[model samples]
Target: MTAHQNGTISAEVSDFLLNCFVRSPSWQLWLSLPLSLLLLLAMGANTTLLITIRLEASLHEPMYYLLSIISLLDLVVCLTVIPKVLAIFWFDLKSISFFACFLQMYIMNCFLSMESGTFMIMAYDRYVAICHPLRYPSIITDQFVAKAVIFILARNGLLTVPIPILSSQLHYCRGNVIENCICANMSVSRISCNDITINRLYQFACGWTLLGSDLILIFFSYTFILRAVLRLKAQGAVAKALSTCGSHFILILFFSTILLVFVLTLVAKKKVSPDVPVLLNVLHHVVPAALNPIVYGVRTQEIKQGIQRLLKKGW
Candidate 1:
């Protein structure tokens, strides 16, 4: 029962079979344990960070608000893709309905973009706090955080909506087997029978436009922050500024390095093993989610103290 019948596209695909790691079935068992732990760690850590920020009066500032936004995005990304991945690994349930697959695609795209945008915004927060101490309170406020939230939501939501919609419009006469754990845009689009030039171009353009711009801005933000820190004559001031930004710097490096490697390998896909990008793509979801709060909790003294207070109260 092919969707293409009599040399014409006739029927619609009801579901997609996710061919996740089909090249090595035995690896599923080996991968399942760590993946499960990572998922649990991500869910628990992000939840705890969000709850701590909400309860701690001292953490109600603009910077912590932005951190909470990032945690929320990570939580959404984990929930959107990881459970189904674990299902495929543990239970061999690899089928996804058409609508469900597209919904997953949309969430992954939207939330990932939001996460990147939030990082850029957080860099700006650091930039202002370091570069212009007198203006930090006036410039970065609760209202600013609210407006940034709106901007991230609207920018990513509007742009990402078209991706899934355009992908769904393509005729899937070839087959409905997406060869990845999650319904990535290219994975789903590559299976379409129709000409997908528009889809490919739009995805490439939209993705780089969002991510590239954010990375460039973050770079400049840190550049200015570095200059300001170097200018400070006080030794204690220099150390404090760098310490404040070290956690963010580490998180950003991890986030962007993995993303850049994945994109490069995917673009030059002929040069690399097919599983490399797929493996990186899957890891990108959980690794960052699991590490983000841990990085913050360990590096940011205020966050560590807040968590300690939370634990003490709980006990």
Candidate 2:
């Protein structure tokens, strides 16, 4: 990444190189073992949850439906990130075609936003069920879930389209070496010789706006839910009331905490190894995907029984 005195060699990049770990090849290969384990767990847990949800007639309710969507999104996110990461870590493949880089960038942006939106809606679901238990059935009907699915799709799909589109317009003549494991938007844009003000501003706006609004609404939803729980008559009544969303709240807590840690690690990068952020970024995708289904399984009675029944039936 040394500068040429002439400053004219940056626009020639036809393919981009990823700065996936540059340690010893053997070191990277050894690191892949744990990463591979995480990918397998994510795929297995989510797929099992999805299948069980589909097979269990009793789980046809809206709550399990939304949970199934979560499992599906987690599976998609895990696949979108991990296989290429494994290729880079294990096989030392770093070069990504220009088109492929932009495509991956688009998926990363759009899907992550959609998943965040999904979490927000899930919080609203809990809020309604807790605050207005009598109307839960009518309010969270199949049609309502369908509308939510459409909103999640339309919101992120529209906002994130510009990210990769604008990125693809950049002139990457300087170099292709992305200083990160994945085809992150900034990682690729920073290599371009062209002015990246538009790209940077758009991404910053898109990410913060989408995630910010979702987090805010989710916060208020849970706040009301907590208020409702505290007003119950007896201690047993309070616990019973909380059980309606106890599982969702627990998973959401874990999800948000890990995500916050990842953001913190980025801001404090000077205190850690140069490689630390990249490692955290890579783990951020897979670890959550792997953890979601497992946590849900433990906390949810119906899903637990569903999983047990599946095992007994040897499916």
Candidate 3:
């Protein structure tokens, strides 16, 4: 793989080594406990939420159905990256095969976008519930949830497939040591001998398009929702409306805030330590996953009641 011919090395690479926070070994040691806890929390919480939603017939509504989709995506994101991160931290298992690396990259790319799309749909769901209450039942139906799920799956799956494919096409002569924990598209492509301009440009375009569009729509939905919420003159109406959206809004903030910080750090990479972005990148995967179900369970009365029933039945 290292042999260079005509300014390019062989693309037939076997495995890539992950350099996961190696500069500060103590940092890994400190991080291992919290990271493991977060992984367990994410897995357990999402599983509980999924099972609760499934068993509770009342949760078959569009909002809960969308929540289940988010939980599923959270589970996928955690399983994709956290176990390997824990392995790297504890057992020093940093070597990932070429195929596995690219597969991981694809999942991270696709699932994250799908999660964003789901969030957008959820925002629309809330908008309808709050702004057009009378029509929400008809508008956000089983059919609507099904079509939204299909859109998320198709859009992210089709758009992000090219990222890993383009990345794999590049020749990797600059050693197989990936500086980040996971096979981040940029991290892997940076190690390639080929000009990664196309890869970088395409990734930027697609990523921003997916996330940007989702965020914009979410903003508009919430804006209309806010306007509708403010006009309510009935007692407790504003509180009820805000409470309904509180959990989703908090999750969206956590997800988008971390991502925004990561992007800003990447832009100011020259000023910031390189590890900041890497650390944020890793946290971005697990933190929201860990928080999603917990927030919903605590804030949503129905979910809390459903969980209580689930526990009682299990016991």
Q: Which candidate is the best by lDDT?
A: 3
lDDT of every predicted structure (CA atoms): 0.90, 0.83, 0.93
Per-model TM-score, in order, reads 0.96, 0.93, 0.96
Q: What is candidate 3's CA lDDT for residue 211?
A: 96
Using lDDT as the measure, name the better of candidate 1 and candidate 2: 1
lDDT (10s digit) by residue, model 1, range 17-103: 899887766667787898899999999998999999999999999999999999988988989998999999878899999999999
Screening candidate 2 with a backbone cut-off below 3 angstroms (N, C-alpha, C), the clashing residue pairs are 10-173, 10-174, 11-173, 11-174, 12-173, 17-176
Model 1 alpha-carbon drift over 4 Å, by segment = 1-10
TM-score of model number 2 = 0.93
Q: What is the number of backbone collisions in each predicted candidate, taken in the order shown? A: 0, 6, 0
Summarize candidate 2's per-residue lDDT along 160-228 as a digit string, tens digits.
999999988887777678988898888788877889999989987997899889999989998999999
Return the lDDT, model 3, position 189. 97
Better of 1 and 3 by lDDT: 3
TM-score ranking, high to low: 3, 1, 2
